[model samples]
Target: MPLKSPITVVATSLLAAQALAVSVHNWWDVPSDFGNIAELQSSIRVPQGSDPIKTYWMANGFGNGYMGMQHNSDTERRILFSIWDDGQGSKVEPIRHGDNVTVGTFGGEGEGAQSYLVYDWKAGDTVYFRVQANVNEAEDYAEYTGYWGTDGQTWNLIASFRAEKQPYWLLEPYGFLENYGSDQSEIREGYYGNFVMINSNGQHHTPENFQFTHTDIFNEYREVWDQRLVEQGKEVYMRIDGPADQGAYPPAHH
Candidate 1:
C-alpha cells in the first residue's frame, strides 16, 4: 500500500530574504528572429558584468532539447538532460545539449538538434525572464516557474524563461518545484511515504500516495523560498485550481 503523506509545514523566512524586485513578462510581448545575432537579446534582462551562464533551447534537429553553460573563456559546457521531452510529458522538455554529442533520440521523427549556453553568474544575481518558441515556426509561448499547492489551480510566476534574441519569453504561472529523492521507495517507515499521485485533470494530490508532502521539511523550505523571491520583488506563481494548458508545446520541437 502507498504510504501516508508526511506531516510537514512550509516556512517563508528564507524565501523572503532572497526575493528580487522584478516583474514577470509575457513571452509574446518580446521580439523573435534573433538567433545567433546577439548574446542575450530576449525580453529578459540580466545585470551587467555577468554573461549568460546557461541556456535551454529546443533542438533544431529532433531528439530532445539542450542545456548549456558558458566558461570563463566564453566556451560552452553542455549536456543532454534526457531525450524525448526531457523525460517529462510537458509540451517543452528541458534537455541538455552541447557540441558533437549525440545525446539521444526522440520517440518518433528523425533526430533533434539541441542547443544552449551558459555564462558567468553568482549568488545575489538577478535576471529577467521571458518564454518564447523553440524555433520561428513553433507556436508562441511563455515559460514560468512557481509553486503548486494541494489544490493546484492557482499559479503565480516566480521567474520567466526566455530565448535569446527573441521578442518574447514564455510566462510560466508557477514557480519551480524541486523534488528530492525518489518517489518510488520510502525513506523511512512512518517518517515519510512513497509515491505522489496527481490527478490527471487537476493538481489535486493525496498525502498517502506521497503525492502531497515532502520528506525534508518541504513546507518550511518552500515558504522561505517563496518569501525570499517575494522580497526580491519577485512573486510566487500559484494556480488557484484548474487544468493548465498541457499542450502548450508543439510536437515538431519535441
Candidate 2:
C-alpha cells in the first residue's frame, strides 16, 4: 500500500496575559507500515537567542513528553527527555542511566519519568539526538532509550524508561519551540532536520514532508506575538516572539 499524508494538530489553551509566551509546534506525520519504529534520529541548533531561561528547543516531541535541550536557568543547561505514564497510574519504570543522568518522576503536564544531564550547551552548536525503543505491542508495552551527542563523538546515553502500558514507536514525530519564561519579548529560533527512522524490519526512511501549527486559544492580544515554522525540504525553522496579552498558537505559517 502507498503511504498516506501525515496529519498536523494544533493544541490550544489559555495562558497568563502577556506574561508567558505561547509554545510553537511542528510535526512530520510519518506513518509506519513496515513495522514498529525501532529508532529515530535528528539534530537541532539555535543560531540566536539561546540564553533565556525556560527556552526549550524540543527537537523530539510527541503525544506526551519531549526530548531536547533547554535553558533551564542562567547557569544550567540540560539534555532532557521524558515519556508519560499509563493513565491507570502506572508510572514509567526505570531501566538504565548512562553516566551522570538524573532520573525522577514528574507531573503537572502529565505523569511520567524524566531524565537529564547538565552540560554547558551553547548556541550555534549542533546537537544530535537518537531514540531507540524495544517495543512489544503484542504485550502492550515498551522500553525506550534516548541518546545524544555531536558528530564523531560517542553517543551519550541519557536514560531509559520501561513503560508498562505506554507502547510507542517514532512513527509520528513532533518538534516545537517554546518560551516558557514570563518574558515573551525575546526572539527565539531553531533549525530542525534530518529526521530519520529505522523500523523493526531494518528499514530506514526520511519522512515525505512536514507541517507547522500552533495553539487554538483565541484572543485579541494575538498580534503582540508571532511564530513561524517554515519547512525547507528535510529541515524546518521554528521561531517565536512575543508579549501578547492573551493569544494562541497560530496555524499554516509555513
- Per-prediction count of colliding residue pairs? 86, 3
Q: Candidate 1 lDDT, tens digit per residue, 119-214? A: 333312322322212323143322222111122233212222332222222211111222121221111100111112222232322122111211
Task: Judge candidate 2 at residue 170 and give its lDDT.
Answer: 55
How accurate locally, in lDDT, is each candidate?
A: 0.21, 0.68
**Which regions of candidate 1 deviate over 4 angstroms?**
1-114, 134-172, 177-254
Taking the tens digit of each residue's C-alpha lDDT, what string does model 2 give over 145-166? Answer: 8899887256889998888765
Give per-residue lDDT, candidate 2, residue 214.
59
Where is the poorest 10-residue window by lDDT in model 1?
Answer: 186-195
Model 1 scores a C-alpha lDDT of: 0.21
Q: How much does candidate 2 score in TM-score?
A: 0.81
